[model samples]
Target: MSTVYDCSRPQERKDGLAAAASAVRSGQLVVIPTDTVYGIGSDAFSLSAVHSLLAAKGRGPDMPVGVLVGSWSTIDGLVLSVPYQARQLIEAFWPGDLSIVLRHAPSLAWDLGHTKGTVMVRMPLHPVAIELLRETGPMAVSSANRSGQPPASTVDEAREQLGDSVRVYLDGGPSGDPVPSTIVDLTGDEPILLREGAVSIEAVSEALGGVQVGRPR
Candidate 1:
């Protein structure tokens, strides 16, 4: 990757944001800051770009990547189903550390690792991430590291693994408390706790008013 963009620097941040967004629009990958951890982001609508992201991370096509959005409206548009309980979770934990896996809209022509019909969507709270999402519409983002390696919490770490695979790096410093977002599957009969991370299962259950959810194995 080229020079790491110091996102804390105002002018550099503005320029970096523009460059990053442009790169994404052109189906290029960029290391970006998210509320939970650093992510390798690309245009979600671009199948080739998504493949590039998977290839860069040394990830298999079977394991799908998650899509990051700027607002609830965008989430609603990209997904076909959004149950009442899912809405509740979004309201409670969105723009924070929560990921919702919902059935993807069949009308949309995008492949996220041949995910069948589901896509994980998140709305991050970080300023840099939000701005980029706002400009890019939706980005397919995964942890900025090789598939088996521990997730990178800083731009330097991401660059170390990703190297020239990514075109640009938005350095937001070490991601504070690099826990991943909680993942919940809403396509099943009931909400299933896929992975508990920043948000606890207790919080999710409470948000749903004691709805039963499958525990992580």
Candidate 2:
């Protein structure tokens, strides 16, 4: 049976976080809460763990997953370049609802689905998620649900979808926002809005010094 952790208590939260981190270190999948939704995550550097997470979600390798980091400094090491505009956006909206896609560092070893030379990255605002990331380093995380299902916003929802496939479910109460993060592509000259969720285009444009918002090509 999967280990379900109640994060409401401080001691339980720390214990759960430690167990989840240990799972990730051992290449096991753990479902943790994020600012946007529950995410099923594994160590970003573990190829086997990445594959396991995809299989657990019934997700194809072509659907890329987002890499969750605890801080902005971690972002620099993972992606090739954080553009000036992207940096501004990170400064303004990060640890909140923004996710940026950039060219992946060539030396990185794991495959996050079909991302070839690119990576989707975010620093989630939720304290539990951040604590887990800080402990496990970086996690290859995607919304906790079956491939085509709506993302789970609560631990119960994640349990219903993932169940025993996931080793641990960190319950940090229902996510503050049911909507997913606003995904922006920063690899190109003009910012491309991939998925509109929490962050609005106007906010992103203002952060990038009035750069025109364009649809993802």
Candidate 3:
């Protein structure tokens, strides 16, 4: 059985965050509301937890998972090096809707599956998500839905898809628009646009001082 918390209530919000953090630490899955859509998340450094998250979504490990951080400073410890362009982009759109891919630090002992020594990370703007992340550290999060299904914009929709697989569902109400964060790859010398979602390519270029972003191949 899973617990659903209506975060509109103060007490429930507090309880939910506690339960969700506990679940993550115990290697369980949790559903959280992000700025764009609901996400199914687990402890990023826990290999078993990441596997469970992927299993719940009927997703393959080859696709990999993205990690969500609580703040900008949290990113410094995860990546091998934060390039100048990455810093500029983060300053321009962090805590909003931008995901950046960079080489992961070799010292870390986590497996997100087939990431090829890289990790996609972002800091979401949603309060519930940020609070949970701050308490639990980085989390491997993917859209709250089964494979081949539409992303869940509401907690109800997330529960319908993930069901008992998720230990806790933090309801932050309807996530307007359901647009995903734009993904930029900073592993190479230049920035590459892997996917364009909420943030536009034009906006990204402007943030990087007119540097051309390689279009999605």
Q: Give Cα-based local distance difference scores for all models.
A: 0.91, 0.90, 0.96
Candidate 3 collision pairs = none
Residue 166's lDDT within candidate 1 is 92
TM-score of each: 0.97, 0.97, 0.99
The ten-residue window of minimal lDDT in model 2 covers: 172-181
For residues 104-207, could you state the per-residue lDDT of candidate 3 as single tens digits? 99999999989999999999999999999999999999999999999999999999999999999999999999898999999987899999999999999999
1-217: candidate 2 lDDT, tens digit per residue? 7898899998899889989998999999999988888899999999999999999899789898889999989998998877888789889998989999999989888888788789998999989999889888989999999988988989999999988988888998888657989999888778899988899999999888888889965
- Superposed by TM-score, candidate 1 places the C-alpha of residue 115 at a distance from the truth, in angstroms, of 1.3
* Segments of candidate 2 deviating more than 4 angstroms: none
Q: Model 3 has how many clashing residue pairs? A: 0
Question: Model 2, residue 26: displacement in angstroms?
Answer: 0.2
Looking at model 3, residue 211 earns an lDDT score of 98
Largest lDDT belongs to which candidate? 3
- Model 1's alpha-carbon lDDT is 0.91
